[model samples]
Target: MARTVEDAAGAPHILIVGGGYVGMYTALRLQKKLKRELRRGEVKVTVVDPNSYMTYQPFLPEAAAGNISPRHVVVPLRRVLPKCTVRKARVTELNHDEGWAIVQPLAGPPERIHYDYLVMAAGAVPRLLPIPGLAENGISLKTVGEAIHLRNHVLEQLEIAESTDDAELRRKALTFVFVGGGFAGVEAIAELEDMTRDATKYMRKVTPQDLRFMLVEATDRILPEVGPEMGRWTAEQFRGRGIDVKMKTLLVSAVDGRIELSDGSSFQAGTLVWNAGVKPSPVVRRGDLPVDGKGRVKGTEYLTIEGLVRAFTAGDNAAIPDLTQDGEFCPPNAQHAVRQAKLLGDNIVRSLRGKALKPYVHGNLGTVAGLGLHKGVANPLGIKLKGWPAWFFHRSYHGAMVPTLNRKIRVVADWTLALFLKRETVSLATVEQPRADFELAALDGAGHRNAERPVSENAA
Candidate 1:
């Protein structure tokens, strides 16, 4: 139902969509700055997202490898933004021209929401290709659910390898293949390989040497963000660990776990991780909002949607001008998104006060990625670091940036615990459908005083 709120409520509404990094940060800043407006009920902040939490994505690889607890990597929206109305829903339609958005609740039919202003920061999803069998076999590392599932899947493969009698079956069970060479792909494969190699120590039959790890990339190098030299070095690091770093190769097909590569090679692998790239969120094309050729909401350096009144966007979904470089847009990364959200929040507040909006300018803080526990690479402020120092810097920097003091403390605690204890490797794959045994029991009448009884003839 398209219902309108009466003005008797008094305060103007500001609806924020996509409660990720941008949405959460923007609303937090607004709540503090517009203290008067919020306290006096002069303005209302409502945020709509599919989840009730904002996930800190950088920790996903660690979470998948059992280095960090999955629970610690996500921030609860309701707890973090008490002043903001956090609604769990998916935005199906947004027509800012009429100041209304149609959103479907998590479990219900679509409903319409009218807002005075809009913030589109829904973020991006993994860009997928039409490679055969990828739909059935490929796993992604985007969300916590996917991370947990990957952890279980990897562990289960180890168990399979340990129990299998056939040599080819064991080989297939131990083969792990990853597609893509970007930050996500490299870090994920590295961390996961590290964990699995360690897991082999506990298995009776499986050894580190038995596992085959391969990274398939279409490009000549990996981690282009760190430059070709560093990318080559990173590839060498993986190769040294017995990982097949397949450069200039693409996953042609994976029909029924038969991974066919563009390099005229094929393999039977149990795992396929896709981390090729990300396009902007599909939300951008929903309305008349201007967008670049890439489908990202066209945003000025000021972080406002071009010529859209009271409309602002930031994060991966927005193609905000890259004032730091010529003829380039800001690359969609956590470093940029976190910085832009602060500026976007301030600009939104400034707009409310009818003040001039300032253009966003960010100095590249450089990139840092952890390969495993005590190994990584970092380029912070032009100083290149590798090994343990780089790994420490990577964890320290991300810990400081994971949003909210509570999450920061929790993540730090998770790391602290990892130092004392071995990696957690409990695979709860059956938990996905936990009651199957009970359902089977019911079907077979396994425990039945009533099941043995005949139905009454008088029963309807």
Candidate 2:
């Protein structure tokens, strides 16, 4: 147990964990609604997260494809929630029974904080499986950093294939495999394949045909959220574009860059992207709070944790009941997360003021997915759209929902410029190891000095 900070008397303190969709939005609403309470010191709000920014995950594929700047996809938490106290730390332990949590800061020892209200929105992490070489070689597409790195890595592989004379090496460098057929996997592969094909126009030796993109899905269809007909259409579109959509197939092993599939196929790939799925953050189960069999904290339609009126949870980590559909729960997606957060914020304010709380009962509005520039699918209000119109709708909806006006302008500007300008395909892989060049130079300088020195001096 860490030393608990002395709780200030009179005012009730609200402590929120994680700065992603739910936490950020909840804080934003609370700060705006409780301005008078906060100013008068009648109530307090503090947000604790490992990162200071909230990533708009819907734009991650675009960011990875270089359609949008990586910086524009993330909103700074402190800048957005100026009225609330933003603590840059991760909650390592939670003891709801004692009304305290142990938080570990990036640079300091752990400390405990006490609060009257709690909000759990730690979000989810990439669901990795126990397959050979996956832990060593596979890469994920969950964060802004990962997306940028993937872009650099893909471009670098293309350069390698273009310069290499060895046919096997070239083949390996040109082959890209993606496991899973969910929205993340589908969008990532589509955007990257489109970008790579467009980039080949500038290469002297590499052509779009040389690139082999494979999507391995255990399930029979992709993008189940878009319904069966749309999923079939998506697969057909991918196949027509020269992408190998291997349905009802599984990746058996990927040992040392060599991929073996359940269908008795083996191949070498330079890039292996894993977007299988995501699991709830483990911290949600650290306390005695009730959780379902899937490890998600149980939540009521009111957005409050079950059996705990003062505690709230939303987003990927909470299994909140879906009131619109009997015996069902809300799906873990940005649309639901954002809406639940707004309602939760209002409910919390109402609860604080001794008012009756309302239940969250919003039906599924729609679903949209972008398949690279001007290609998309959407089912809004039961009206199915395809191609350019769907793509336009996808951009419009997300652009409108991307937090602040500053980011909205930046994202729109990036899209607007991309329409007229030629695609930029330069690889900056060195950004992953910024100090590598300086370190190599230092080693070379040391070698040169050693060579110039006398034999005895060198020996010494």
Candidate 3:
């Protein structure tokens, strides 16, 4: 039924499952390779995602730190893939054998889509643990939305702390706790601390030293990707700044703003940020795709799943071998994901033409992290760099890598302005609820003010 329906169009249909790093790049590659076919509608490409844009996640930390505007970190799929159909929908399930997928749009009923090719680049979600109060209070930095919200929430906490005279309330408000000492947690905590500490210097009754920051790591060391020496150096730098680094510690619970740790320590911290880890998107399992124990799709170096050559997978979703290191899979990082998407795209095009497939192989260029402002740590190309050079390199590398020329320019522009101007400490938290003022004004102190309006008036 699916094949017959798609065959009626007299063209091959390519369906991309996610509008993330892999999905966007794959569609762009297809659009470039089959430009003539796309013009004639001989080959149709469709990308379905909840958001119409692909977010450059590396810039997320800076975006949250207000070093870059939130608007510049995301690329609109429609703008990038003009030749492809960009559908703002969530793929509920995909059945490759049936050659069809069930997708739910923003407001419409679920619809079945038939396609000749499927790209399982659905990406990963924040790995959540079954801990109490986690669902209610913990925050993860997986999306640009989450990053921006965290920025606002952190600044708002400062506001709460300053407005109150209660020492307990102020301590609770001023204290910030970050669980997971990986790159995400370390960078986030570092950037946020810098921002808050700098911000505190100007606020009334608040000193930079008043803010209490703590990092809780289950492992003895953080940022194992950069090697132990560098990780320890990074941790030492944090400790020098008076930030507590609790190694080999775990967050047992965060119930009712009371945080309990595995080391028998307890604290009343109002903010709890979780960046422990990530697992493959649950959608992979929902679709019944072949995945490893960790829920990552099992795929070969050619970026194709086992027994399904036509269907390609990459990024965090697929568990492809790391040729650089024996007996290990590719680390789920931006560098590997971006490189994999480029090769995955070419492999898909080759598969269509019955051409030879090339295996994906890319070595780590090295890791660079911005501690804050002019402070950073890096191990780029095996050269260990610290202080200004690493910090500048960190900014420059990420600035160059952020997708699209428009965004790259804007991000640099934001940085350039920062040198001459102060970092914007104003928290536009109201962005979360833009209609609150309107809703209040349009009320009668009981119910909605326009309840008696006709359908036509309400619509207007």
Candidates 2 and 3: which is better by TM-score? Answer: 2
Give TM per candidate: 0.95, 0.96, 0.94
lDDT of 3 at 22: 90
Q: Name the lDDT of candidate 2.
A: 0.90
- Model 2 RMSD in Å is 3.1
Every candidate's lDDT: 0.88, 0.90, 0.87
lDDT by residue (204-267, candidate 1, tens digit) is: 9999999999999998899999888778888999999999999999999999999999988987
Report the lDDT tens digits of candidate 2 across residue range 107-174.
76789899999999999998888999887789989899999999999999999999989999999999
Per-residue lDDT, model 1, residue 53, is: 96
- Top lDDT hit: 2
Going through the candidates in the order shown, the clash numbers are 0, 0, 0
The segments of candidate 3 whose C-alpha lies over 4 angstroms from its true place after superposition are 1-8, 442-460
Which model, 1 or 3, shows the larger lDDT? 1
lDDT string, candidate 3, 1-460, tens digits? 2212233366888888988989998888888888898899788889999999999887778889998898999998899899999989888878888788888888857778898888898898988888888778899988889999999999999999889999999999999999988878888998899899888877997888889999999999988888999999999999999899999998888889898999999879989999999999877886757899899999888888877747889998889998888889998988888888888888888888889999999978999888888998999999998889989999989988988898889989999999999998888889999987666555554665766655445444
Model 1 ranges off by over 4 Å: 1-10, 445-460
Indicate the residue-level lDDT of 339 in model 2: 93
